[model samples]
Target: MLRFKELVLTMQEFFYFALRAFATLPKAKRYWRDVLDQAFICGVESIPIVLVSSISIGALMSMEVGNLLEEFGAKTMLGRSTSNAVLRELGPLLMGLMLSARYGARNGAELGAMQISEQIDALRAFGTDPIAKLVMPRLLAALIMFVPLIALSDFAGLQTGALVAQYYHKLDPGIFWNSIYPRLLPMDFVVSFLKAPVFAIIITLVSSFNGFSARGGTAGVGRSTIKGIVASSGLVLVANFYVSKLVFDIMH
Candidate 1:
């Protein structure tokens, strides 16, 4: 009962806090440039990793499917299984996990450090909307970064899957590509990418908020870091299910 009540309270706080955050966006309009800059840092620079991971994952996933299907003489199904996994799950999840580890940790530490040093307070003293200037950019950056990175990850992962099928799976390269060809479309890519921005916004906002509102000195930073990663990852997984269902339903 206590846990359930706490869950309810958390949900209430989340919705309420989100509402309040939305209302404050107008006040942060002047800081769009800052947000873009942060987006580039948190989102763009993370691209190479996302890309490599995505492609490698693709190849690896294909290999897994190849192994399973080899017994059934259904090696051609490797493409579909691998593609579906990437499009439906791994792509967004991997990207989200990566961001949670990289961006989430950094956001928490940066904000926590600022809070402890009283720099956040100092910003308020200067009549700046710290939430607007600091939090909002991070939020916007997240929104912008998530989708592109996910797309990058998915594409890379698929190619990796193909490579695995080609090499370890002992499948012909041409046949593997041909089988994979029918499984993907431009629209599938779009749908895969679409999930990323949402994941980005959720993580970015949550981590920044967690960091900014954190207390307890040195321990608080560590706690916030863990919380941010957990929250970001949990939300990403949960959100992916709903997003995938909606996208597939619409597409079909």
Candidate 2:
């Protein structure tokens, strides 16, 4: 019962924190430079890991799915199968998890440190809205940047998958490309792109909230950072599934 109450209170506080962050969206102009900086950090710094994970997953999926399709004498469907997996599912899903670890961890650790050093308090004492100065910019940056990251991840994954299909599966590049383009649906694109902002929200808010709630000095910073990463990563996975399901249900 005590644990349940604490959970409820935590939820309440988080609701207020997120509300305040969103409420400060109008002040974004005042913090445009911070928004741009955060965008570079989360968007530009995030590309390599996103590419690495998506390319590896795409290659593996193509190889495995190609083999299985070969057994059924349906190997020509490799492009279509791999396309659905990569673009509609794995591509965005993997990007979200990667950003949750990389971007989310960075936000958590940096903000946690600021919280511990009383920098956030100092901002408050100066009559500045800390959420506007700190959290809002991160939120806006993630919101703007995650969409392109997802698009890049989808493109890289499909390209790698095509290469794998042609080389390892002994399939022709023309056939693979042909199969994918004709079968591609607007719904697939919808499902893929929509996950970006959803993931951005989960990662930014959860990490920043954990950071602001940090305590116990240096050790606490580490703890909060880890908690932010873990929580955001888990939420990313959950949001991935639900967003796909919801989109498919409503659109299909």
Worst window of 10 by summed lDDT in candidate 1: 14-23
Q: What tens digits encode model 1's per-residue C-alpha lDDT throughout 1-252?
A: 999998798778766656665666776558878877887888778887777667767767787778789989998777778887888688878888778888888898899888878899999999987777787777767776676677677777877777788778877777776766766776577667777777877787778777876788888888877887888889878887888788878888
For each candidate in turn, the TM-score is 0.87, 0.99
Off by over 4 Å in 2: none
User: TM-score of predicted model 1?
Assistant: 0.87
Q: What is the C-alpha local distance difference test score of each model?
A: 0.78, 0.94
Top-scoring candidate (lDDT): 2
Clashing residue pairs, backbone N/CA/C < 3 A, model 2: none
RMSD in order of candidates: 2.5, 0.6
Structure candidate 1, residue pairs in collision: 54-156, 54-157, 55-156, 55-157, 58-157, 58-160, 58-161, 59-160, 59-161
